[model samples]
Target chain A: MTEKSAQRRPGGRTARNRENVLRATAEVLLHEGYEHLTVARVAAAAQVAETTVYRRWPSKAHLAADALSELARTDNPIPDTGTLEGDLRALLGQILALIERPEVRRVILTVVSLATDDDEVVAAKVAFWESRFVGAAAIVIRAVERGELAPESDPYELIEDLVAPTYFRLLVTGRPLDDRLVDRSVELALSRQGICAAPVPGRPASPSADD
Target chain B: MTEKSAQRRPGGRTARNRENVLRATAEVLLHEGYEHLTVARVAAAAQVAETTVYRRWPSKAHLAADALSELARTDNPIPDTGTLEGDLRALLGQILALIERPEVRRVILTVVSLATDDDEVVAAKVAFWESRFVGAAAIVIRAVERGELAPESDPYELIEDLVAPTYFRLLVTGRPLDDRLVDRSVELALSRQGICAAPVPGRPASPSADD
Candidate 1:
């Protein structure tokens, strides 16, 4: 087997090294800011050889991008709960929890700050958002199949409507987040599909259970 | 008369000095960023004495706060179009125009970045948003008076819904802003008030005109 394939084997030294390096990268980016982040610093913090980090991730931009993407992936997993409301609540719950962390808030604000001037960061930011939208698309697709959403509904717009208020409150307005915001967001998004949260007369109490 | 009263006179030298210093403070914050902004640098840029700037705004944070607040006030004026839809469209249009400027975007991102670490900046941000909400409260109050909305509708929530998506797209999703998004935002917020943009059959087409 090739050396690269061998290194990439599950639970191998390379896997451990990657996790350490990404964790160090995030720590440095969060505490020290982006300008202070370097491959050498990350490698030293991770207790790995500098050459190893360079060989695996050629640039600081790539390192930062991967670190953020990893954080997003691990912190938020797509929920497959039966009802769209349940799925939305679950997904938003994960997002709210993730962003509430001091480190996560710093990372998000820092990336957005850098993205204003750095092309690499801009690309990374766009890719990060695209991955999130793609992952959440399944929730929309499932709702459409279940007749909770119209077949012609755009998943991206629906998701945007659902999460924009939360992010806006957090990042722009600096307002507090509470259960009311979460419930209001879900209600607004579902309302767009003409799917009321309250049960109507003569309708199945739980549509997913009947299906 | 008190010495402070003399400085407060309209079109006086003190007024010109205040204008110059504020403009210079914004220039430094926008171009050099928050970390680089100082009373000395602003005084130099404004062609005023350092003591003059220090006397009025004692701290960099105070200067930064005033500069941002000044930017927000001059760039956007609350619209009084005599209709909720017209007012929302006008207000959002101004916001879109302002944020699309590179300098304005930098100022906004910079303040948010600094607010995370600085107590004064946090207070400043809160005050900035409060002023904006208070300014726009007139729109909602007028709409209610015209029977266009429920009397109990929360004005803050209505304004939040109207502007959150735009800020979210700009700062979080990094998406392009267009007329469609603006229209959709206005529609969604108005829909919450049960106000339809399209006229129904056998109704006064222009409700504002009828009033």
Candidate 2:
């Protein structure tokens, strides 16, 4: 529904069917959780044959991953508020909003559960995360480009460091995520680039370099 | 068999019985995953009556949670290596090692899966994590006492920030956890308190405060 998904691949009817099927897939995922999702059910909901769903996504994991990825790509916004901090805060806010959604939580929990055992699902999970970080990474990219951050700062890794804690808290520690949490995260990451005051240690001023 | 679990609770025979049953519970959890784990199977494996296992720990989640909590309490080391960085690196290394273990991974994944839908399991998971963090919290406490950090800094939250990324990588991104990752995490955290040099910001010295 966002856009470009219909134009992402070649072929007309085939692409349209996939879009419709994936939409139905999302509905089922939200309504029933991943445990009850099936190609048959998806096909029935999409008003297509079981063979059609099977021909595209061999497993439910594949279908679910595809559907979620499409939705995120087409709908998820890339915040550009000029300042890196503003952009990151907006991005984290969006993520927090998404995680608080029961349907989103179900999809995430299901994918994570599958990612534990299945190699295909693991790959999908990795790709899904890598792509999701695109918007976040752009903030870091602009900061680096404008000399707001060090030239040596790795954008992808920096985004991971900034956001990984939120995921960690959500999935493992069960801590509440808030705007303050997001701000502190961005601050900690910014500290690495000398954007804030660094606290002292029981040593000489300079830090020793390591490879 | 860490010490004190034998002496922590009630009657001598009862304590011994619970410990043995919990040990058996762990064995079943490791060998078969949680799907096949039951009080009857654990009782048979422990050479105790099924009624006894049920009498002590009503649910498998309860039993498993108790076992893991006890083990963490007794076995999880409280690192005091003079420096905050030393403690953090040592703690994160220990966590990375634990996460890499097959049995550990299985236990965590199974518990996390159950925690998704089961309220009791969610409570267990929360208790299990809070207790596991006690050791890590100690490290942060020592750092604050040693003048390495601010007095008002929350030790538990700091430890959560330090360890969350490792869990995120293990459970979600499927990225490899290594010494470099550990070192970067420690460095980033240290940067927060000005223990390391705060890199310069391009715009202003002061970060804007938010309500």
Candidate that scores best on TM-score: 2
Which ranges of candidate 2 are over 4 A from the true structure? Answer: A1-8, A47-59, A195-211, B1-11, B47-58, B73-75, B197-211
Using Cα atoms, each model's DockQ against the true complex is 0.27, 0.29
- TM-scores for candidates 1 onward, in order: 0.80, 0.82
* Tens-digit lDDT string for candidate 2 (A16-96): 788889999888888888888889888988889999888767678778878887777665677888887777677777778
Error of 1 at A9 (Å): 11
* DockQ of prediction 2: 0.29
Alpha-carbon shift of residue B207 in model 1 (angstroms): 26
Q: Chain A TM-score of each model, in the order shown? A: 0.76, 0.78
Taking the true A–B contacts (Cα pairs closer than 8 Å), what share appears in each candidate?
Answer: 0.40, 0.44
CAPRI tier for the interface of model 1? acceptable
